[model samples]
Every structure is written in structure tokens, then in C-alpha cells.
Target: MTGDNAVNIGSPQPPQKADVLARVCAALSAGDADTAKAIIDTDYPMVIGTKAQRRYTLTETLRTFYRDGFLDRYSGTQLIHPGALRTLSMLLPKEFPAHLNGKMTETHFAQWELFPTIDHVDPVARGGADDASNWVTTSMLRNSAKAHWTLSELGWTLHPPGDARHWDGLSSWFTGYLTDRPDLASSSGYLRRWLRATRVVQAERA
Candidate 1:
């Protein structure tokens, strides 16, 4: 058996599915919709809600919560799960008027159960008061199950966490994942452009 401390620098390790998922989550957290789109394209079909109660473009869905200006409006600790995504896709557009563009408070709880993680309260206090960590909490099994189901439905295979990879640089990371996937790149490119345009518009206003 290989020694536990052994280092095999020459060995080739395939990318793990968790690594990709984590990257996708991180990109979503960072408001990098391009990366999110690329990841989604490789894993699932962009399903828009057809019912009057639920209607939105995939772009709009991502934009509503993951976009730069709106991200901070929602709590970051809440993760998006497939079930919640499906539910939200069905519920959101129908609830709001077309001209009144904004998010509501209840939307935060729209997909809470879908998260694999449980929310843990922090013991540490900060700023002369209580500070807590209200992040998702769940067992590893549940997390893997959610990821597996999502990928399987999308006709994709998942890599094990042991084989996952990470990069500290965002641009390099995006380029690496997107370079060979032209179809994904194309779908994500418009979002990237939209983000850039938004930034430009904000800068001009500032």
C-alpha cells in the first residue's frame, strides 16, 4: 500500500466533481455569472419556468440574486439547491409585477430546505455584540446526493472530492475551465458582457 505520507508529484490526478461544484458555488458567490453559466451548461439544460406562476429567463434568474448589485441583498450563507431552484423558478416571476423590479423578503426562505447544510450559530461575539455564523449545515452524504442527482439529470458525471483541484486566481481558473468548452463559453459570454456593462454604467454614474 502507498504510504500515507508519500507524495507522488508525477502522478496525474483527474479533476474532482466537488472541486468543480465548489468553483461553481464560489463563482456564484462572487457574482461571476459567466463561470456559473459555463458550469451549468456543462451540467444541466437551462430550464425556464413555463407556468404563469413561475416564469423567468435563466439569465434573469441568475441576475436577480447572483448579479453584482443585488447579491448583497440576499444572505450569502444560503446555498442554492436544485429543488429550491425549481421551486423559485416557478414562484418568483408570477409574484412580481413586470415594472416593479425588486426582490422580496420571503424569497430568502423559498429554497431553504434544498440546502444540504444546516445553519450553525456562532459562539463568538463581535463589535460589542453577538456574532454568529448562519451558514448551511448538512451531512456530507446529503451534499453528495444533491450534487449527484443534479449532474445525473444533466447527463454528466461527477468526479470525487479526493480528485478535486483548486486555483487561487480567478481569471486563470475561468480560462482553464472555459477554454475548451466553446458552447458553454458562448452562453456565458453574454452574461460577462452584461456584467461589464453594468459596471461601466455604475462607474459613469459614480
Candidate 2:
């Protein structure tokens, strides 16, 4: 398959998620829920952790991804395209942001002991990348507040969202997360929303 058609999760690939992607795709394409159910049951372990941690079951994990706006295709508060949704993006390093912003002599932290999470300035729902340029350091509260909403859409006037110039730079350096995850792209209703927004902006500018 071409690079545009599938998510390339880097070679020396791991198992689990990759193995299920193919099976789920076939089931969905053929409208076979029975096959899909069987695939998920066998593919994703109901529990995780070496020390017998009772984490999310596959169903639970899928539900979370959909609820959290991670997947492009969601049904109310649940995932529709389990195959396309696949897995969450790889986590970034905690110190990586500090290192990237190293030129700054000062750093700000709103919450003590709160780990940094990667957040998109433009938002994937409104067209944004998943890489360094489009990413910003954020706490869980900030990230949750910013969930799937664009800076302009929310009328926020602080930090990266407040800075129009930063968003412009990110737009120029753009590569949407969906570019890598084509499965999500195929079902992303976000594209239509983005297009409508774009047309309105263009019309206003004109």
C-alpha cells in the first residue's frame, strides 16, 4: 500500500495493534460484526501490565478513544471504526519540550508535579499536525479544555492559542495526524467541518 493509505508506525514494528488493523478492516469492509468481535476478543488482551494490572478491556479502551476525540470516526460517545482507530499516538518525552524551548531562560508551570502532555495548537479536528511544530506543552486540564476545539473556535486569549503567529507557523509546517493514519482520514467528519469553516473565512475575507 502507498504511504497515504496506511499509518506507518515505524519499522521493527511491534505486535497487537498492527495485527488487528488488517483483520478489523476486512470485517468492517464486509459488514461482519461477528468476525470483528472475534478479532478484538483475541487480539487485544482484556488486561495489561506485567504485575497483573487490571487495565482497560478492548471494549473499554475503544470507548475511551472515541469519547476523548482521539479517533476521527465516533458514534455519540463510542468508536465506530475500531480498525481505523487502531492505537493512540506514541507519547512524547517529558523533557523534550524544555529542550526544544531551551533558548528561553524562564519556564512556566501552572501545576506542580503535573506531567506534560502534547496538545495540538490548531487541533486535529480543525487541521493540525502531530509533530513538534504543531505541538505545545500542556497540563491535563489545559489539554482537556482544548479537546478537539480550535483556538479561534473557543476565543481563547492565552499562551499559544492567543498567539496568531504561532498558529500560522504551525499551519505552514502542517501535516495532519490523519495524514499518517489514513484509516481515520477516510471516516473523519472533521474534514467537512474544516472545509465549511474555511469557506466562511474565505467569504469574510473576500
Cα-based TM-score, every candidate: 0.18, 0.24
Q: For model 2, how does the per-residue alpha-carbon lDDT over 141-165 read when each residue is reduced to its tens digit?
A: 4567778776665776434122322
Q: Over all chains combined, what TM-score does candidate 2 have?
A: 0.24
After superposing candidate 1, which stretches have Cα over 4 Å from the reference? 1-52, 66-72, 78-176, 181-206
lDDT of each: 0.36, 0.41
Report residue 165 deviation for candidate 2 (angstroms): 24
RMSD (CA, Å), candidate 1 to true, equals 23.1
Backbone clashes in model 2: 0
Q: State candidate 1's TM-score.
A: 0.18
Cα lDDT tens digits for candidate 1, 3-77: 997768798665576777887899999999898879867754344422222233333332332222221111222
The clash numbers for all candidates, in the given order, read 8, 0
